[model samples]
Target: MTAKKEVVMGASTENPAEIQDGGAMELVRVPAWEVKYKLDRNPDELAHFVCCRDLDWRRAVCGYEEPEAVILENPTTFCTMCVEVVQAHGGVPGSGRCPFDDQPCPDDETVDRMIDERTSRP
Candidate 1:
């Protein structure tokens, strides 16, 4: 009998606290903040600000040399930098207590829906 490789789901190696949205993990597009930057002259740079860069510790995990360089958005994982900033500021990082009071970090369904909406747009 051949043994199957058991794949562990939920939370990425890069971030243990990250939330997993199961299958939605397959379709994560750019960060939700991209909705704002889609029309900006400096979209890349401005998008980074949405994840927050004021905290010094964020620079290490963020891995972006310039705000304009970050583009990948993992649906299963909240931005580590964003998480740290939220926790540091006494707010939570997930759907319950997202840093942006107006825009809470959405759940898996919301993330996937946003991606679909963006793609379906004319």
Candidate 2:
């Protein structure tokens, strides 16, 4: 049997304070004010994609060369860049965040409903 390493989920390797587990860490999508860009991004490209760029050490994780290129493409992961873009443009008019933003564990009723719906689907 192998030893189970305790993992500190959602810890940024860039920050010394976030490191809790002595083993591997999980990459976080949220960008706190102190986070520096660890991913490989070019300065030249960074100059153009202002829509996805945050006015901080965070780099363009989306890697779009032009401004608002992500909108032209399909959105997948929830990132700080996406949040910045949405908020910068007056944000969502009403309540309720994007369904993709986070995956909270379904409550008992919600889970039961989902299971019933899926089972009933043709």
Candidate 3:
């Protein structure tokens, strides 16, 4: 079995603002501050690292299995450079290729299709 891993955010924290719902139903709106880091790390790399760390470290603390991979809303914009770094480390970018293999990266259309499929799913 692949070794389980967890990622933990080092110096980043999220704060949310609560807003009242205007509709008849009682609702609370919690607007979160986007994830932010203290160090000058590449955003994508940071995200990847955090994901890995969470799977490798924090999952155990929280009592869960490590996630195989993370999904980003905008894969292209979120971690282009980090993908390159992960690729250099032998991992595939975009298609979840093994970092230790030479598999071809998934094309943009594949990613788009995945996004569309996910969004369309109920």
Candidate 4:
């Protein structure tokens, strides 16, 4: 069998009128704290965070609300109740529940405790 050559697409040419003679491109700056916080979180967690942001943006931009569902397959995923809330609010993949709230617990420490508990158990 003969090997087939793949065709490549070229980059589109830029418009001359779009370029400014003296004006320089301005870079929009996001807060350093936000960047640092985002980086410190796990990639999967970050994806969920971004999803929440996108949901908010969608609501603001077009008044369109996405249906949210809580995935409870994994401990890391959101709880079923939270998913229902997200769906009611028109969000997709609602925020997860704290893993360590058997009776009553603080939100911040629950995740770390849950991780420890899960790791210790198995």
Q: Candidate 3: give its CA RMSD in angstroms.
A: 14.3
| Candidate 3 residue 83 C-alpha distance from true site, Å | 6.4
Against the unseen true structure, what C-alpha lDDT does each candidate score? 0.33, 0.29, 0.32, 0.26
Clashes of 1: 0
Q: Identify the leading candidate in terms of TM-score.
A: 1
Ranking by TM-score: 1, 3, 4, 2
> What is the TM-score (0 to 1) of candidate 2?
0.17
Looking at model 2, which ten-residue stretch has the lowest summed lDDT?
Answer: 1-10
Q: What is the lDDT of candidate 4?
A: 0.26
Return whichever of 1 and 4 wins on lDDT.
1
lDDT of 1 by residue, 44-112 (tens): 322221332121111322333333322334323334554465556666544343453434454657544
Backbone clash tally (model 2) = 0
- Supply the TM-score for candidate 4: 0.20
Q: What lDDT is reached at residue 90 by model 4?
A: 50
- State TM-scores per candidate: 0.32, 0.17, 0.29, 0.20
Q: How high is the lDDT of residue 17 in model 2?
A: 57
Q: Who wins the lDDT comparison?
A: 1
Model 4 alpha-carbon drift over 4 Å, by segment: 1-34, 38-51, 54-76, 91-122
